[model samples]
Target: MTSLTCDVAVIGAGTAGLAAERNARKHGARTLLIDPEFAGTTCATVGCMPSKLLIAAARAAHQARESDLFGIRTGPVEVDGPAVMARLRRERDRFVSATRKDFDALPEGTRIRARARFDGLAGRLSGGQARLILDDERVVTARAVVIATGSAPMVPGPFAALGDLALTNETLFDLPDLPRSLAVIGGGAIGLELAQALARLGVSVTLFDSGTRLGGVRCDRIHATLKKAMAEEMTLRLGVTPEPSKDGRAERIAWEDGEATFDRVLVAAGRPPNVAGLGLETTGLRLDDHGMPEVDPRTMQCGDAPIFMAGDANGARPVLHEASAEGAIAGRNAVAWPAVVPSRRKTPFTITFTDPPLVSIGEDPDDSAAIGSADYGNQGRARVEGRNRGLARLYAAAPDGRLIGADLFCPGADHLGHLLVWAMEAGQTATDLLTRPTYHPTLEEGLRGALRQICRAVPLELPGDSDPGQPPGL
Candidate 1:
């Protein structure tokens, strides 16, 4: 067996692993990056990029079909499934190729295309560092190791029996042709996004969610609105417990309320961390209930070992941006060794790219929080655009009027989500937000309306009616 040595070893070549490897190299450490699959980050390859491509196509088709609402008559619009899939593959392959090129451009021999496992405490090197045994029978020794193995979709035992008949995020993008009818299991981001996209594309989609709400929208009003909107587009079966069975080429799934036979089944169940076969015992670290290494999220460091866990493997925050931040922290701490420094976290923000996208940032709205709200039914920009339905509710600390959270189900929610994220990060108060300039007849004005309510709720001393300096209206 060949033997190699490096100052740091990063497992996995996805977003988090790449970030860790780059940062470790920048810190003057000889870093080795290993993965059976090269570049092709999850976002670009299977998760975000390809899915958005499909969503974009569906959006164009939907708009064309709905043009009559704007007094513009467009004849029957048809979506060519094969052509859409072809375009998706062409564009997706190009993105993957670009990522591969970038990875190849890195210093020669720095990346190893093989699966690796820890050699355990009993097999430590002379310097007391951990060893990694590559699938190719190569042994690697490193002073510091970062596990960024990422995650894989979890398929329950029943669904696993269906084999090729079942689809997950990892396999859905690779489909040869769109199914005539589909049954989407789970109502999380992946499930809801794909279900709606398919329904818009003229597929008979029946969505089943074991949960009481759709897409995890905790606010009752927002959940109801989203449910109504989605219902208008397709069949939504919430609070369902599904029993799936395979019938040759066709699949039959039955829930408590009803049953249906779908041409294909797409499981959007949660992803479990890819921790299997990593030999956790060898790392001298204790595993959590989820079988993942116990590590402090702030430092991304495991117990007292030189090992660190980042990205989906850590199971802290599964979003790509959060994974990148954790990866940077792990990379830095790996190099610094005994003196690990904590990293500042970004304000929490999540968005689901559906029509009138759903967004939630920072703390979730609750009863204890002061509420400020605005409806888009009368917003000028929304009315002019002919897409005026949804609401924005901002939550502030009751005592100090600090902008703490926001939940929005409105047009242009993606932009609104980012704005709220920045406000929370900067510790801006409701009063401070109102001071910012807002243009007329814009979606942002809806945000201004909410802030105004918050300012009105706070007992700010205004000019008295008897004061001569007060304006006539005041």
Candidate 2:
């Protein structure tokens, strides 16, 4: 059998694994990265990129269809579904190529096309080095290991129905044509994102979740806003338990209260750590009570001499951004001069890319009192732009006025990354935001108004002390 050794071994060549390899190489460590699949899921070939391409095309079709609102008229609309899929496929190939190039770019890093598993727990190889075996029976020895083998969609309760019609995030982009109607199974970020995008594309969509959509968000207000905006189209089945997947025009899914029908079932219930057949027993790494690898939170070190876990397999947030960040941190720290462990950072910001979008950062809503909020239903720019329905909430330290959290219900909240990051890391205060110059008639100016509005909640007296509804001259 072929054998090799490296300073660091990263299992899984997805975003997390690739990032880990790059960081390890940067720190002057020899690294080996491996995954069974040539094309990484989500970030690379199928997940976010291709899906968003579909969303953009879908939205463009929608806007073009509604041009009458703009005092313009166009021919009756027909969505070219197959054309959209073709474009998505072309984009996906590019991403896959880019990911492979990222691996090739890292010096001293070797890419292996195989799955790996620990072979023994002696904590030392027969040759006084740690050893792992590949699926093809090739052996590898590494001083440190980083398991960035990321996550995949969980099969919903009814496994039998997955036959052909059912699709998950990994398989959705392969569709040659959009479904006439789509039933998204799960109300979490994945479910909501796809549901909204498909619905806007003229696919009748029904979103089902056992819990509330946007569950566990720090702000209920944010969820409410999302619901209001999303309700413009699509059916949202909240707090619903789904039925088994079955063959039919309408997949019959049941909840505790009742059942419903959907055309295409897209299961995105959740992700479990990819731990099966990993040969952890050979490394003396025991699964925790929750059946996840028990490891030091800061170091992610498993048992014995060299095995470490990162990304979704480590049971961290199953978010691509978080996994990639964690991988970078863990990979570099694992190979530092004497190998100093890294501390995990607070998840910075997450957004649901629905209309108007929803964002949450820092303070869990349990600390909502530290939170202050402002809304702009009708403002100068909003009116001029013929836009409304935006809100921004601030969570600050009561003692120092430092901003801890900022949830935006406005447009382009994603681009507020730098300011928001500073607020969290540097403890900048709401008042400090005043110093940042905001362009007039731009969406950003709304931040200033939101800041002032949240900072002061005093009731303002109306003109003439009138209730306005009591007749002006009376």
Candidate 3:
């Protein structure tokens, strides 16, 4: 077998691996990035870009249908499923091509187009080193390793038996035509987003969530609003699990209350880390209950091993931005191993991009000292757009008005979530955010309304609030 050596080896060429490789090189370390499939990043390939493309088309169709409310009538709208899928593929390929260009521009010999597995230790190196066995009969000895293998969509064992009849993110984007009917078997972000999108685009979709709630919104007011909005788009089967069985030439997903057979079953259950066949035993690292490497969340370093796990591979924070941040931490720490430098995690920001999207930011509002809310039913922009169907809640410490958390279920929420994410990260108070100018008749005004509630409820006493238009001393 041919042999190669590097200071660091990064497994997987997805977002996390690429970030890790770039940061390791920045730190003056010789790095080898490895992945069997150099197709593109997951977000570009299937996760985010393609899904959004489908959603955009679906929204256009839904909007056209709903335009009658505004006295704008476009009659007899028909959806051509095959044509829609074709356009989706074409646009998705452009994004994938762009990502591939970024990968191709990496320095020569930096990326290896092969799968890798741990091959025990390299005794020759003075410090602890790992031996990586490549599929092409090549070996690499690296002083430190970063596992960024990303993840795969989690399909239940029974669903796996359906083969081509069942679809996950890995296979969903590749379909040449849309299915007539679909059973979406998870009520998380992916499931709800796709279910609603497909339903809007003329596909019959039934969404089932085993849990009592949908998304992660803990507020009853917001959750009820989201559930109502999504229910109008697709059949909702909340607090129920579907029993799956394969019948001749058809698949059936039956629940206690009802049953349905569909042309396809889309599983948005969860993602399992791509840890299989990596030979973690050879690296002397024990896998956690989730079959993920037990790595420090801040450092991304695997336990007691000269290795690190980042991004979806660690199975903690799986979003694109979080993956990138984790990759940088893992990369830097891998280069400066034995002496650890941990980084502080940023304030958590997660958004589910269904219509009137669900957003979770910062701390848990359920445990907050005080909670305040704004109902979008009265917001000007929402009323003008005929989408006034959600609410925004702000959590803060009472008496001090320190912003702790914020949740929203409102139109244009993806953008709205970012504002709160920044504010909470910068330690802005509810009253402080209220001082910022809010554009009249915009969705952002809803944030101002929510902040005002928090300010009123907590009543933070600022020096100037006692006497308006006068200096505090005067």
Q: Any idea how many clashes model 2 has?
A: 3
Off by over 4 Å in 3: 122-126, 366-368, 462-474
Q: What is the Cα-based lDDT of residue 254 in candidate 2?
A: 72
Q: Model 3 residue 406 lDDT? A: 77
Best by lDDT: 3
Q: For model 3, what is the alpha-carbon lDDT of residue 324?
A: 94
On a 0 to 1 TM-score scale, where does candidate 2 land against the true structure?
Answer: 0.88
Cα lDDT tens digits for candidate 1, 361-386: 87665666777887876677887888
Q: Which ten residues in a row have the lowest lDDT in candidate 2?
A: 465-474
How do the candidates rank by TM-score, highest first?
3, 1, 2
Error of 3 at 197 (Å): 0.2
- Which clashing pairs does model 1 show? 120-282
lDDT score, candidate 2: 0.70
- TM-scores of the candidates in the order shown: 0.94, 0.88, 0.94
Task: Give lDDT for model 3.
Answer: 0.85
